[model samples]
Target: MKYQTKIIEKPADTLTPVGVYLRIRDQFPESLLLESSDYNSDKNSFTFIVAGLLENFKIDKGVLSVNHQKKSIENTETVKNALKDFIAQIHVRQPDKTKQFNGLYGYTGFEAVKYFEDIRFESKPQKDAIPELNYGFYRFIVAINHFNDNMIILENIPDGETSQIESFKNLVTAQKVPQFHFKANNDETS
Candidate 1:
């Protein structure tokens, strides 16, 4: 995988973690933001704003999506094995780990208990419910360093596209908050 990395240094208190997240939430689909609540704690450090989705795997539903292409997950394969295969397909060759971070963020919960442990908290997929394991394949992420107050936009440019980098830079460097069109964050203060 190829990488196009951009580093932005910001003045302390100029850019709140939520402020950074809001800028891209509307622009990117399947975006997620995470922040540390306590700045003083070492265990809870740094803010991660994950944007863009290259691929998604909804494990519980037995579905895999690559560039919108869908396929059924194998029943015989263990979840871990399926995950390894999925990662191998999209991220077969690991990128250089020299960067601060490079990998997808995911959680294993609820139904996953059946896979690793004998315990059963599992159930069939229901309408409008969270999946057991939903993993996304992202080429990059915005990593904020809480201690130093630096925001870095990281990207793995598999296709060598620089346009998205420029857009991401704009998203992070906007000087002013956009006026809330629907009356939230507006002067009306309803």
Candidate 2:
């Protein structure tokens, strides 16, 4: 699938999955973000979660193997890897220490094309007020934690067409992210 990479940085408090999703929505303006489970959910059961989409990618974190003692780390690394592509879209000050620094893997992908065919009201034919959705990934995603306090940084990894890349740049430049302390990789950063 085609993909776009970015670095997404936010205050540790604001770096939740939902926050990441909202930020991407605000930035991309025309992308459908869905999680792996959501992707599998029935049409009537479809629900949106900020982090759901990112979790679908299941990006590799390069950890040797999953261990029961490191379940949290395993989960974090999974999500972190998922967000790696998302993080590659930002620029920040040098980190004093780093954790989960899977640089360059931060990316979002087009999973499926959605078709908002048509809907009918009770009796009368309803005008298709809803916009037709055909382009973009139906399930592009990124990662975030609801209650993380450690400082994190992600640099934007440029991919996709020049216009697409420039558009993302414009969005980032338009609104500056809240400043947070930078740190190098450490086991506790996630």
Candidate 3:
């Protein structure tokens, strides 16, 4: 079985375990069941949440796990250690970076761009209307930007490569289409 993972490194103060878990679940809807367990034998208690996603209704599966108590730490050192362990497990899974990035950007409706210094066309398909031209891998620069309250910028996408920038842009733009706005009401009883 092949799976990928990523270690989240945000500070404990800013960590949101439930939010992360929910996001992961939403991304992998095929997951039928999610489980959380707590182990306590020594002085410390450890809580782990795991979710499984089914693929092809067969062997392919996706699993995500997180330490539920790690987000409640006040001591920086303890938090760091807990986060390290959590990250270690994530890396062990080795999640797909590109797919993860696409999922994140897609959800946020942010475009990511990569610039290619040099790009060349290997072969050009015959065009019935337009003349076909071929270049031996020419270099080009690509930039992806998003229009939202928060903007995300990715630069230097190489040629012959497809990315989620277009899809993200389209989703975002569609959501922002002209819509009805509600007015706020004021009360003067006090």
Candidate 4:
């Protein structure tokens, strides 16, 4: 699988992990920022920040949505099968191990632990329930090397993609994120 790599180096004085995250967080939900504050770390030392979704995986109340292509999965085996099929179908470019930092990055909730352990739950749906699992796959990431004080914008476009997509420069140097002010209509010490 072929993928495009974009490396953008800028002076550390001008750009920072927090600054970059602040600039792009509003543009995309689930914008991730991971920092390894330990100085002079090894090959694992990279601050990764990425927004926007190349694909999304979510399972809510037994309904699975892979990039908004939904399926009702009634059992764990079915859900596992759907995920295997959907995940395999989504990515055209596999991670190139030769690259410095490239692979699947995501978080899994503890419910998955129960599932793997064959544990059952006496669970009830709550208001504004979160998904059992929610994850996203990205095509690009802004990786900052703490040791070198340099930033590399890695854009991994699938080999099959030919259409135009947003660039790292545009994303990083774009307009300021909109700000919002919220006020409580009634104030009480409840």
Candidate 5:
């Protein structure tokens, strides 16, 4: 249930991003996937988007487990408040910047549209979240071309500021998936 973001060396082409996106799709099986224009474009840009209920991320009754982050919605009022806050946050960030903004941007949405609204309006709270919850796990990754002199700036999305999203940031920052970790001995140098 741990969501990770790896900043590997950018591939020579869009093959790596496409591969990653496909791998995620295969893993999720029933996700609402979205590939940025740059992903399908002929340009050498690597941008991919994935959103849907994978195996681990789900919410049942008043309980929710998003990438292993479990929490109860408290009550109907609490759920409403949380949903309001979540929607507000989503609106603050433009959908198009999912890739350009960089790093894993995870959210519970169906498409790039009014997903939470439908949840808030359609589902009637019955001592817990009615109809059970199966929201998409939106994910975004940044492929670094020149990893040497560049740093990932964390200023775009407001999600990083909240304690709720601290785990997401921690996964991306502390536990980065190292792609270029090879040791070279002095004697072995060419």
Candidate 6:
């Protein structure tokens, strides 16, 4: 059976990081998905978080078709261990300087309180400031997903608004999806 890959890019204003993460976790089966990254830095750590969520779905049946780099870490035990290590490391590290730290940490529970001092939200902003902040967030998301060739990026088109499910569908239809193929061992395909 052919699988449907729906790349949902939640609106920065509307959906919190936890909400988006949960939605993605609940919707897809573990066996059907793969999070991609090269073990370069903490920047790609969110991929592991997503993979951890998928691992929850793989408790009974095992995950299949992992991109080779993550093949060893595909099982539930490994994913759980990775997540535990990640959290421990984040805690031990005191301040995570990665972009994911800024985005995901800001919206999560305790981190939200700890990092509240750094937040710059304005209840009553000047007209110019509003546009600038929106542009900044948009640019940030674009940059984060730039090197993620395995994941499909659904951009919020027409500039300032959040991306909708219809927008995701339209983007997928427009051939904006990633062109890379999953490789296992030496095998490759388009």
Best candidate, TM-score:
1
Whole-model lDDT per candidate: 0.63, 0.32, 0.25, 0.66, 0.39, 0.28
- Model 4 clashing residue pairs (backbone): none
TM-score of 5: 0.31
Q: Is candidate 4 or candidate 6 better by lDDT?
A: 4
> Could you tell me every candidate's TM-score relative to the true structure?
0.73, 0.25, 0.23, 0.72, 0.31, 0.19
lDDT of 3 by residue, 1-190 (tens): 2233322221222223343334334433322211224332332222122222211111001111132121332343543464345434322223343232211110110110001112233343334322111111101111111111122212112333444444433332332233346676865563
| Runs in model 1 lying further than 4 Å from the true structure | 1-12, 41-44, 60-76, 91-98, 122-126, 179-190
Best-to-worst order by lDDT is 4, 1, 5, 2, 6, 3
Tens digit of per-residue lDDT, candidate 6, span 36-125: 455355455233222211111111112211221232333335645643443343211112223332221111222122122434343443
RMSD (CA, Å), each prediction: 5.3, 19.5, 24.5, 3.9, 14.3, 21.4
Instruction: Give the alpha carbon lDDT tens digit for every residue of 1-190 in model 2.
Output: 2333334444444344344444566444444433334433333222222211211222122221121122222343444453454345334332343223322222332211111113223333236323111211222223323233322223323234332334433432334444447796766743
Residue 9 displacement in candidate 1 (angstroms): 5.1
Query: 5 or 6, which is superior by TM-score?
Result: 5
- For model 4, how big is the CA root-mean-square deviation? 3.9
In terms of TM-score, which candidate is stronger, 3 or 4? 4
Better of 1 and 2 by lDDT: 1
Cα deviation at 140, candidate 5, in Å, is 9.3
Superposition error at 35 for model 1 (Å): 1.5
Q: How many backbone clashes does candidate 4 have?
A: 0
> Which of the predicted structures, 2 or 6, would earn the higher lDDT when compared with the native?
2
Model 4 stretches astray by more than 4 angstroms: 1-6, 9-13, 37-40, 90-100, 158-167, 173-179, 182-190
TM-score ranking of the models: 1, 4, 5, 2, 3, 6
lDDT of 2 at 143: 34
Candidate 6 accuracy as TM-score: 0.19
Error of 5 at 64 (Å): 1.9
**Selected candidate, larger lDDT, 2 vs 5:** 5
